[model samples]
Target: MTTDAYDHAAVCELLGAWAVHALPPSEQHAIPRHLADCADCAAEAERLRETVRLLDGPDAPTAAAEPGTAARNEPNPMVMSEPTPATRNAALARILAVRPPAPRTAPHAEPYAAAVAALRALLAELDPQPDGGPDLAAWRTPVIHDWTVQDTVAHLIAADEHLAAHLGLPANHPQDPQGAAAPGDTDWRTAWDTRTHRVIAHERTRPPTATVATWRAQASALLACPAANDPELAARAATLVGVRLPVAEHFLIRAFETWIHADDIGRALGRPVPPPPAAHLWRLVRLAVRILGLALGPTAEPVALTVTDAARSTEWILGAEGEPVRAELVLDPVDFCLLMGGRLAPEAVPRAALGDEAAVRTVLGRAARLAWL
Candidate 1:
């Protein structure tokens, strides 16, 4: 095929094989350029690459043997012909089954990295048409907080800037004046709201694709920071988003916001975004519960709350422990998160509650008011 008229569709179809180094050399030359220009294709390529890496296992060879080398000449009886179609299909199925590829992060930054990957995957789903047609306009439709999908991403760019700057990473987009306020000169909320507005306003002046590129680049930079891979660097405490906490938790905050906005975009597009993979969900849930418990305080009546998932259930004794439990609440972990994020109203959220009505109401109301999202 001529380079000038390369068939992107055909190249995309070969991505899986290319990812596994199974593509013939003649057919593989065009993929790099195509991937560089195409966001959807790039995301799919990365996922396929990750799947291939996992299949190869950690100790796999780094390079192919030279054609005339002893290693290449000494083929054992174990060598086999190309896989049959069914065998190939089964291998592909197994690779695809490994959901949410593990993020390249230190233990503490894992949640944030995974959340970023999840959001990238969701955004990749937005472009359903290979030719890139009118359906692209859907990205501009209103999502949450009066922000469109494009605006929501721009908000994340602004949201993540705080931690990025604190780590001394270069800003991907122009910095909002408010975003650079000295610590304690401005409260996080005021600074946050101001920066978001300014960032959105600035982003509106550009195309949505540009805004997304900026956001993606910034997130990539954050994940690449030394702090993301070093517990020692990330252990330092700092004030971000109104909470004085270790840099590690701030990374989680980034994960939390990215997942929340991705959900917002998913909802506006009429797609139900699944919660993060179980382990990441639990991390998020545990963090949110800790914050909620703090918000509930020692004086509030104690309630026995259980958040359940398919594999396990976690129990939290919320509020004062001196009195007999005034209420019992059971919630699916995702529902509890939605409730705390203010995405679900107290009256509307699904839950099982028994005992003192006032205690249940207080817990639910406080949960809704947490509004971290």
Candidate 2:
């Protein structure tokens, strides 16, 4: 049998984690040998050890006292000591112990039907004041990377139409000769009568807040998506989290996108932003599960998890007892969408939220901002 090299990061993380907290003897013995020859792992172990000491020492009296129970909730360190035959077998069995691939998430209740109604109401109520009050006509037309409010609105309508078509519902507008829908035509077979008013107003007004109108349309279109009708209802719901989502994930993403972006639009319009309902929050958490799956795809081991959003920065973390996380930009739904949509830059992410910079860069490469048609 051939022996493969252990990951240096894993070795260091385990060493560091073990120093602060006891490891199973199996892990404790193996890591010392791995670290003895690995300068990188050794260095990391030193840092983690020092850091843990600080937390467990007088400098962190309060922290140290809190976990004074001395019983760490963590797994045995022996599992990580060395990838020995027995340990490897144990690890493999543990890995396979994970439940089968997650099925798509589906809506537990009638999903935001009221949100759709509200969108239609807002759409009808919307009337872009073409008067250009606070005007922006001199500016260039918004494109994929740099979207003006008008361009954003047009894209929103386009996105709605696309969703409508996918659902096998009547689209608000078919692809025209110039490949453009008339500003006011909104006769999609889906429940979109009121959307026309909003779209027409957006086309005419061309203001900064029109982006809000566009976002509103997007929410409505998602509710009306055809995939929501798929027999594999779970696969149908997952897409809301991303460009390609399964069903269960789809509704959760829908809830997140609608509630979050709607809040953004409210912030722009000076409207009181209602907080997302509790159900919406639950959906976002489910969406988080999908993110974990994506981030941990290449990883073979289980990873402990922590997710942070420097106010909507990235998405999740899923790995093992001590592997570099499967994901960096996964912990937060808001940041995940922004990063995926090219709305935020990598530099905008705070330091604490990222696990491995390379992993984030990889996610970025996979999902770039999309251009409007």
Candidate 3:
């Protein structure tokens, strides 16, 4: 069938049946071609196929049962004969097993390295498949803040160049036009926005592939710098992006922005992006909390704040420590990150607040306004 004749969404909905070879012959033929160009659907198809493989494994019980239970003729307690809550969990575990482990990094740069790796994985989904489906040229689709997928990547290339330049790395796009003001003369925020606009304009003059190549090359160069792997090397403080922070924290900042934009692209493409893994997520949360604290200063009303994930919980007292907390707020770590990224509004983010609502609202409002992303 012609590409336009096949509904992309309808093909996507058939992924499960296609994985199990249950689709009609014509659909079976069309789906693989569709999967080739569609990263989101391709990934889902792989997952469904993996699930089928696991479900088709040996019919013997998953574990040995106690002696007396073996001959009961009842459903085998050790074998998953049908889907149950536990069987569903086992299926999910099998699906996750297919993913590669996160890359290793030094303690200080771990968050950046992991976040970079995570974003790369997401970007890979956008890669054009050898067998072909939709034209990869469609990457020009609008992503966020008036940036197309290619433009978003071009923005990151410009963004990371700041740190890469500070580290003395060779520029990936040396011809990129300068903003209105000389580098340091402009505040980082103004410089940042201007750089993004200039870079996007410059990149539009080239093929989207060239933009992706430049971004990937620059990111790889940044990660390869000695500072990324050595805490001592990263300890030298420098001011970039309007904040004075060590090179290590700057690396974390690079990670934070990369993941956020990746999320923007994921959303535009209809894929739900999972938050960063727990360890790296907490690093982002802690850093954002510190920055938020700095923005709030010491005199604001104190609010006892707690952020939690599936594995653990962290607590902090926002505002003056000497004063009793006037309110309490609790949030999921991912929700807090989204709030800090400005993707979630202060009032709309899922959270629990008590005591003085105004004080809690202040903390939430300040967090949402941080706009570091």
User: Highest TM-score, which number?
Assistant: 1
TM-score against native, each model: 0.73, 0.41, 0.72
As for model 2, its CA RMSD to the true structure in angstroms is 23.5
Worst 10-residue lDDT window for candidate 3 reads 76-85
Expressed as tens digits, the lDDT of each residue in 1-373 for candidate 1 is 4555645554554454455444434434456567767787777777765554455556543444333435554322111123333343333444323443334678888777766655655564444333543245777889987888888988898888889889998876666664452344446677778888888989888877678779878887888889999999999998877667788888887877787787788678765456677787788888888888888999889999999978989999999978889999999998988888889999998989999989989998998987855
**Which 10-residue span in candidate 2 carries the lowest summed lDDT?**
96-105
Which portions of model 3 miss their true places by more than 4 Å?
1-104, 129-134, 174-186
Quote the RMSD, in angstroms, for model 1. Answer: 9.5
How displaced is residue 80 in candidate 2, in Å?
66
- Each candidate: how many clashes? 0, 36, 0
Error in Å for residue 227 of model 3: 0.2
For every candidate, C-alpha RMSD to the true structure in Å: 9.5, 23.5, 11.5
Compared with the true structure, all predictions reach lDDT values of 0.71, 0.40, 0.69
lDDT of 3: 0.69
In model 2, what lDDT does residue 146 have?
Answer: 44
- Give per-residue lDDT, candidate 1, residue 21: 40
- Relative to the unseen true structure, what is the C-alpha lDDT of residue 258 in candidate 3, on a scale of 0 to 100? 85
Better of 1 and 3 by TM-score: 1
